[model samples]
Target chain A: MPYVNIKVTKENGGLTKEEKLTLIKGVTNLLAETLNKNPASTVVVIDEIDMDNYGLGAEQISDRRKAGK
Target chain B: MPYVNIKVTKENGGLTKEEKLTLIKGVTNLLAETLNKNPASTVVVIDEIDMDNYGLGAEQISDRRKAGK
Candidate 1:
């Protein structure tokens, strides 16, 4: 029931509408504390991209280098 | 980049080893088509959960419901 679909990038230029509702309430509190679930049946979807359209295995990266790049 | 995290009800018996990978690929294709991005640049995440653990707007539901219900 917890639906979280987050595709990040956009060179950090996106996420403006209240930071996309605070990133779907911070990924619904990190998937309700890592899977315990119950943050009102968390359903978070944040898809934003631009940085070369995003990649990893083939090279390109974002989300700040997939949290590291 | 495209990183999709899908959390569905475990009630579906949860996807198996190959199913998870297939899902990621499916979502990647969807995002690529919808957003006009390269498939290689897409990163998808699928998180499965119990039905009772997810809710939408104070009402519990599943992907089936979210899609229409």
Candidate 2:
């Protein structure tokens, strides 16, 4: 079984349910096509993190957003 | 920098905020101790999946739970 986790910052109120489903399906299919993995046993989890919890370049995402950079 | 994604089943109403915080801290510390990683740049994401979305041994977690297994 292949487990995949996709983490995206919670921007614009996060992703919609349909978008999440699309990501799960697309990732599973890609793994099967490229790595010869079994789609039935593949697991894809999407994590929507708050901007305050995510950091980049020694700065929190929330702060970056506030600065518009 | 190290990125860690933790996947856990959303059972019994999922984990409390304190528990999640503990996991983030513990994982970060473990990485720092074992791999000399920088905790300040480490990213840890926790995913709580629904039983219905998780599968094992060709059976969904929801089904296994219903069967009391």
Candidate 3:
């Protein structure tokens, strides 16, 4: 089984269910095409994190965005 | 930076925020102890999926659970 996890910053109110579905389909198809993995056994999970909870370069993502860096 | 994703069935109404936090901290510490990764930049996310969406042996988890197998 091929398990894929996607972590995305929760920006702009995060993604809609339709968008998440699109991502799931696209990633599954990509693994099938590239790795010959069976889509039937492929698992894709998406995680949306609040910017405040995400850190980069020892600073929170919210601070980074605020600094425009 | 190391990113970790945990997938669990949405059983018993899923995990509480405190449980998730414990998992995140435990995983971060594990990575640091075993892999020399920095907990500061580590990211951990948890995804809870409906049993109906998860399949095994070409059978949906919901169905398998219903069969008591």
Per-residue CA lDDT of model 2 for B2-58, tens digit only, reads 987778888998876656667777888888899989988888777778999999989
TM-score of chain B of 3: 0.86
Per DockQ, what order, best first?
A: 1, 3, 2
Better of 2 and 3 by lDDT: 2
TM-scores, in order shown?
0.47, 0.57, 0.55
Off by over 4 Å in 3: B1-6, B15-69
CA lDDT, every prediction?
0.63, 0.81, 0.78
Residue B24, model 3: Cα distance from true site in angstroms: 16
Residue pairs whose backbone atoms clash in candidate 3: none
lDDT of 1 by residue, B1-69 (tens): 566767767754666777666556655655564445568756676766676676656766665466665
Residue A33 lDDT, candidate 2, scale 0-100 = 96
Off-target runs (Cα >4 Å) in candidate 2 are A1-6, A15-47, A50-69
Rate residue B12 of model 3 by lDDT.
Answer: 76
lDDT of 3 by residue, A1-69 (tens): 687767778899887655666676788788878998897887766678899999989999999999997
Give interface RMSD for all predictions.
8.3, 4.9, 5.1
- Candidate 1: residue A47 Cα off by (Å): 4.1
